[model samples]
Each structure stands twice: as structure tokens, then as C-alpha cells.
Target: MLLSRLTGVSVLGLALLLGACSSTPEKEKVAEQPAAELYKESQIRMEDGNYRSAIAHLEALLSRYPFGPHADQAQLDLISAYYASADNPAALASIDRFIRLNPTHKDIDYALYMRGLVNEDEDRNYFQELFRIDRSDRDPHNIREAFGDYERLLREYPGSKYAPDAALRMTALKNRLARYEVQVAEYYYARDAFVASLGRGKYVLEYMPDTPEVERALELMALCYEELGMEKAQQDTLRVLKLNYPDNEMVLTVGS
Candidate 1:
């Protein structure tokens, strides 16, 4: 009878031990569901092209499970949605936050790429805005700012998929910038403002060399020299202009 009682206690203890082990894993499994469900819902919303709804679902998931497995992916999706929806400022803000939060995330490369993407889009918009301006009210300062942003993206994200796009943008931006300098120089030249025109025109060569404007720059410099009574300087400038742009009508006009 005593042996039977001891056998019963051993069996009962074994059952209890198994139940405890099983319960812990079951609790963990339960804890994991909300995040999984959230991610699933976000994916569904994304597939439907309801980016805002996807973002909301992901945000809710993150709010409830900050350390969930979906956190990194959730961050990326949220920022991408903002970008797709034309919420650049918000996209940039979210990207910045994510970078600060997960500097070492495995998909850091993707984050970097997205950052470049947003900046490229920003540069496109800035130039569009700058170009759309009335010539009567075009601001040199705004053009300069747009150029600066383009340079920043090119410099910072050289390996981005958007690099080619940024390069194309830079080409257009530089041309506009070069043209702006030429226009300013011409304005000064028209008023017999040789000194100011020479300064502004010379600025273009420094900013963008070997362009169509280079001939104009040299021609203007020659004019500045003539106005200043620097005959040797005038002749020397004209010689270089002729050497480089022998076929330009202005060269003939100036020489004649």
C-alpha cells in the first residue's frame, strides 16, 4: 500500500512538470500573435494599395509591441508609404527617426537607399518649383538652395540606385545655374556695367567650365577690358575666345 502511494506521487509530479513546461511555450505563442496578425493585415492593406491603412496597422502593431520581430520592417514600410503618398516631409522625418533608432539594422542599406530616393525626389520638386517661377520674380537664392540640395544627395548617397537620377538632375541644375550667372552678367553688361558683368560672367567658368557660356564669358571679359581701357587684356581675351569658339558669330562680331 505504501509503495502504491509513492508510485501515485511520482506520476502526479511528472504530469505537473510537463504541464509547466508546456504552459510557458503556450504563453509565448499567445504573446506572438498580435504582431503576426498586424503584419499580415499591413501586407493585405499594402497589396490593396491602401498605403495609409497599411501604415496605420503597422503603427498599431508597433505601439503594442515595440520590440516585436516586425519592428524593423514596420518602420521601413511606414516611411515608404509616406513617400508614395507625397508626404515627403513626413517620410523624411520617419526615415530620420528610424536611422537614429536602428543605425545597425540589417537592412541599413535599404534605409540608406530610401533616404537617397526621398532627397532625389525633393531635388526634382525644388527644381520644378524653381523653373516654374516667373522670370520676373525668379530668385537666385532659391536656385542656389536647390543646387545645394542636389549636391548634398549626390555627395552623401553615392551608391544609391537614385545616384543616376541625381546625376541627371545635377546636369540640369548646373545648366540652369550657369545660365542664371550668364543672365546676371548680361544684365550688368547692358547697363555698361562691365566690372559687375565681368565678375558675374567669370563666376560661371568657375562653376561650370567648357560650357556654351564659356564663349560668352570670354567675350564679356573682353568687353570689360575694353571698357577699362586695358587694350592688351582685351586683345588677349578675344584671342582665347576665337581659339575656342572660332565659328561663333559673336566672335566675328567682336573681331570685326
Candidate 2:
């Protein structure tokens, strides 16, 4: 009985081993494919929205033929695949590698744009989206990085096809950043930290002019000045606010 049981266990183990080996043959076949064939397969997979499979094929092609004619295009496609598959870190690393290696490549603008998109997306996750939580008051580090990426893309490639979209995104980022500053100032002011609140408000005015939040920043600064007993500064801030926004509620109330 013991011998029969051992034999049955050995048979099950052998079947498992065979199943593993069978799976590897397909991978080996993929690895042996020429660079062009792998690239074509990856393209097909990408077109089918199978980004995970596309990433595998693109990575294999790149690893096997780093100098092949398709290498550059494969690298760019790999970044897209990684991003589509929600592998943000991999996408960013691939984008940086492509930029560092191909600084003057014709598609450098696209890489920069993708970098900005990835960073911007990193600031929001599925939970935030599902809950419809406002992200403007969150930490702005990723938003700042994305803004810088878009700014660089526009500065370096003014004539790029991506320029218009980059410019629009930059404007939105500027507004969001200005709003973030205002929120921080509000937090400080609520705590009676008038000096810190004033500094934050000044940051929005000086560095983030023309944003919609500028009016709010000015109002907050004036209030902070009042709290700190800085009458002259409060008057100056209110004057500027009224000049820019004659119908502002604070201006009308203070005048009354």
C-alpha cells in the first residue's frame, strides 16, 4: 500500500513538472523571435489593448536587439505599454532612459509629454476617483513636477505638435498650484499663524499671477495683515485686490 501511494504522488509531481515545462516553451519561442517579429507582435497586442502582453514583447525585443532598427520605436512603445498597464514607475523609468539616451530624437517631445501625464496621474488614484475627492488641497509635489515637465517640453520644443496640449496642461497646473497655496494659507490663518499665512499668500501673488486663485490669495493676505496688526500692508493688499477685482465681496464689504 505504501509503495502504491508513493507511485501516485510521483505521478502527480511529474505531471506538474511537465505542465511547467510546457508553459516555458512558449516563452522560449517568444525569446527566440527576431526583433522585427517581436515588435510587430507587440504592436498588434497594443492595438488590441493588451498592454501587459505588449510590454512583455516590447521588453523582449529591446533586450534582444538594443541596436536593431526597431529599438527606438520599441522603447517608446514600451513606455506607453507600461503606462497603459498602470505600471507608473516602469513607465517613468523607461521615459527617462529614452530621453537620456536619445536626447535629440524626433519623438523627445512625446516622451516629455508622457512624463508629465504620468506624474500628473500619479497624484490621483482609484480611491480618489471613486470617491470624487478633490485633490487640489493635497500635496502638490507631483503636480509641481508635472508642471515642470510640461514647461520644459514647451521651452525646448516650441514647434512640437504636443506644444498646444502641453501649454493647456501647464495653465491648469498653475491654477491648481495657486489654489493649493491658498488652501495652505487658509490653514495657517485658521490657526492664527498670520506670518506664515501671509508668506503663502505672497507666494501665490508673486509666483502664480493670473491664476483665478490670485483674488483669494490677496483677500487672505489682507486678512492675515489685519490679524497681525499691519494696517499699512493690509491697506495696500486691499487696494490691489480692489483694483484687480472691483466687484470683489471683500472690497465692497470693507468699503461699506
By TM-score, who's the top model here? 2
lDDT of 2 by residue, 106-187 (tens): 9999999999988887876554554568878999888999999999999999999989989999999999999999999999
| Model 2 steric clash total | 0
Number of colliding residue pairs in each model = 0, 0
Every candidate's CA RMSD: 21.3, 12.1
Model 1 bad stretches (over 4 Å): 1-33, 58-67, 99-160, 190-193, 210-212
TM-score versus the correct structure, for each prediction: 0.61, 0.87
In model 2, what lDDT does residue 225 have? Answer: 88
lDDT of 1 at 42: 82
TM-score of 2: 0.87
Per-residue lDDT value at 143 in model 2 = 90
- Locate the minimum summed-lDDT window of 10 residues in model 2: 1-10
